[model samples]
Target chain A: MPQIGGAPSGDGLQAVAMAIRILEYLAEQRGGIGVTALARALGTTKSRVHRHLRTLVETGYIVQSPESEKYRVGSRLVTLGRTVAENFDLSALAREEMRALRDTLGQSVVISRVEVTGAVVLATLPGREAIEIAVKPGSILPPHCTAQGKLGLAHAEPAVRERVLLSRLDMRTPHTITSPTVLREELARILERGWAVAPSESLLGVNALAAPIFEGGGGMVGAIAILGSIQFIEAEPSALQIRHLRQAAARISAQLGDVGRDGVDSLPR
Target chain B: MPQIGGAPSGDGLQAVAMAIRILEYLAEQRGGIGVTALARALGTTKSRVHRHLRTLVETGYIVQSPESEKYRVGSRLVTLGRTVAENFDLSALAREEMRALRDTLGQSVVISRVEVTGAVVLATLPGREAIEIAVKPGSILPPHCTAQGKLGLAHAEPAVRERVLLSRLDMRTPHTITSPTVLREELARILERGWAVAPSESLLGVNALAAPIFEGGGGMVGAIAILGSIQFIEAEPSALQIRHLRQAAARISAQLGDVGRDGVDSLPR
Candidate 1:
């Protein structure tokens, strides 16, 4: 939206610039990079490049071999990649459960993570019926108009909730919430009820129900939601369906909550 | 080893330090980081930290969310991690093949990538026997003493081979190639034979046979080798064993060679 970078903010900015230049150079080369090569490529002095590389090594952005001293990307960078890619999203952990939920309800299932801008669907499973709504993975949905979005907004921390609602609520369909007051009322109900239902809010004749996915750290991470034509799924779910959906969501949340604490994705030796 | 980064050498060094400091701070936060928070954590001025943040975002060392403008690690760092972790090693892709190779031969299998200094074993599958040789993943093997190491050296680019040969050839056992001339002769023979074997060079009564793993890019990325006690495998492989090992290595090399070109793990959709 607004211009973010480019102005010289301080001495630290120059350091950040050089460090990034080195990384950009390293990214181009698949093999290990040397200080001389980086300096030559960036049109700088070798000694200068070497000093920067040493600092990068200390911070774990650049790793140097014990014998060769050749630098490559560090394991920490990979750790960060996993963070950005998943962002506390638990689709891989909830994949099987999402499929099971879809089969049980015979409705389309969607798991989405609420981002600063909007809700991003991480994964989805189709309904038992041949005809089903297919939400592409990575597709974005308005926070005020979908079951997954409602669950996300409902469970988000107050700061995030307030910021997300600051913008005008563009209606996706006739049933979509256009008033901040009404949406806030629904969110309160969702927090108390532990789930949210949006009937024909995203698209006409479509209804969706969702449950919040929580992390072990006591934060709402995403949502496990199911939607279908009003003929199959209405605004409210059957007691049994609600239990199954919430149970699956809760189970996935529990499993993911212990990720870093229990070493869920750590190296297996 | 030499007290790497506490002392800065030049103006460029300061840039490197600031960039790395930002990365280290970013690693500590799971959510998003703003310029103001980063400056406070590092005890630097906010304007300076903002400048550094801009450089990181530009180089992909840090990512800025369009909606939040909060910085985190970018996707490119993940790409770099894959390169450093498994770029030259096919163990993960060849996992099933390695298992099959072991099952068929009833011996332990080791996969290693040969770097400038030595060979680093990426993965291993224990043999069928109760007393199978155990080679830990990430174990380093001397180039002069291992079948995988020799295979790597024999096929390496001339510059690397020359450099490795220049290093002292320490004798591991009486059978190890302590003389550079003799090792060169064996390497020449290995080039002709498409494989290499080292008998009792590493241990008193163990033998290993290795074949070079070739990527689609025409580089010998690593070696796939099988080893066991002298009683089971002996000093050299039988023609049948050689054929099986080569085929397995070739299959894995083919599968992984297209990674950089095909863009397989770029980002999960």
Candidate 2:
């Protein structure tokens, strides 16, 4: 393997550095990026940028717009990202369970995983014959406010939780919890109860319930969440649905080889 | 911004070259790459590779798998890749219509676009119920056997189609049309009817119907495909569903600013 971003010692290392710089610049830009603008942003000559762009193009890591002479990242990168997601296998394992949950709860069901930096929605199965909520795969939501985010944070290691608490948390809605103390308390409660709920926190008029999915190593690898419009979610008479959600999560966790704490070690593969 | 592959005149270009070399090596592997293996593969020192890997990690373009200590592409790259996909926006415009088709036909629906080298599935909506046949987003199917592939080839330039015809087309299933003459005739029929079908051609017991999504500039940007198990699709004997699929494709193409027989002036804002 060639060095990715080390100091320019050789041609290979230099190429990798340039590619990283180019990707970083493109990531910062919300709209499409042009060659000249990218070159300017990196403080490099346009001709040089063009060559790197060509290499990125051939590799399907980046694409050039036919309408505008701009370059953007390509779908191949998404395929690669999905490979990281494959290890979790939450989608495949929970596909039927997610569908069953959505059918039973009549809400959007989402499976989310804790990544190195943030939480990402791995899969979403919308409710039957309902107003659809488009939760595309790869959509990232902040851990402090979302139900799955809270569940994941509640189950994360202390050091990881502390880091999250200290990091800047974006408030997507007015009801979003911004204070670290409040979030910490909420996470603790969620951990104790083995479930979490967020009512119009991340997005107005959307309520969500989530429970953690544990990996074989006793780590919370992901969460199964059910989301619905506040009107629908709140209209339920009792917390029975919440209980059901927890049961569903537990079943999924069991499927993932999480036998209760007492029997987990003795369970056969 | 930086030169990626070509020989650089200075240190900056040298860095770009190194990155490209590393990327090329990774591309060849088609699997997660280890630092030591990559170092040997690139004939570079491990420390140098480690440094470059660190830089790639910092940029969020590549991630080190905790399980294997091997490097794979990262989700950030997928975020950037999705930006490029958003730039295309053909799928975004067609999403609603695809949903409608899925509802109407009760089949998995796919929207695909042609790239310079191959065709890529831009978006896919699973059927109303759990179906065995589900084409994933970013799944690249062969251009010769799939219904969408045939639609794409039918509308492509004659010379391009000829080139494809000359190449060997792998038979994915026993029913796949591998004969060049048969494929050419099928392509002709597709061009004439503006639609194509594959009855258990790509996969056993799976069938697909596709129609080209063409722009006003006479460019066939993509296709709308409805796929299902042969049993269900054959049960509904109606050209109306096929027309609906074609009409949906046309609506999407129009949304891409296609005005039939006139050049694509501008996409719908």
Docking class of 1: incorrect
In model 1, the runs with Cα more than 4 Å from the true position are A5-12, A27-30, A65-69, A83-109, A112-269, B1-12, B60-70, B86-107, B112-269
Cα error, residue A110 of model 1, in Å, equals: 1.8
Q: What would the per-residue lDDT of candidate 1 be over residues B1-269, giving only the tens digit for each residue?
A: 55464454532356566666676667556666778878888988998787777666555456565445577654345445444544433566578989989989988999887665567888998999989786888889888888888888987768778888888888778898888888999999998888888899988888988877754334566788898888877776787788788777766654543112322221111
What DockQ was computed for model 2? 0.10
**Per-candidate alpha-carbon RMSD to the true structure:** 18.5, 15.0
DockQ of each: 0.12, 0.10
What fraction of the true interface does each of the listed models get right, in terms of native contacts kept?
Answer: 0.31, 0.18
Off by over 4 Å in 2: A1-15, A27-31, A42-45, A65-67, A87-149, A152-269, B1-33, B41-48, B62-75, B82-88, B91-195, B198-221, B224-269
Q: What is the lDDT of every predicted structure here?
A: 0.71, 0.70
lDDT (Cα, 0-100) at A33 in candidate 2: 81
TM-score of chain A of 2: 0.63
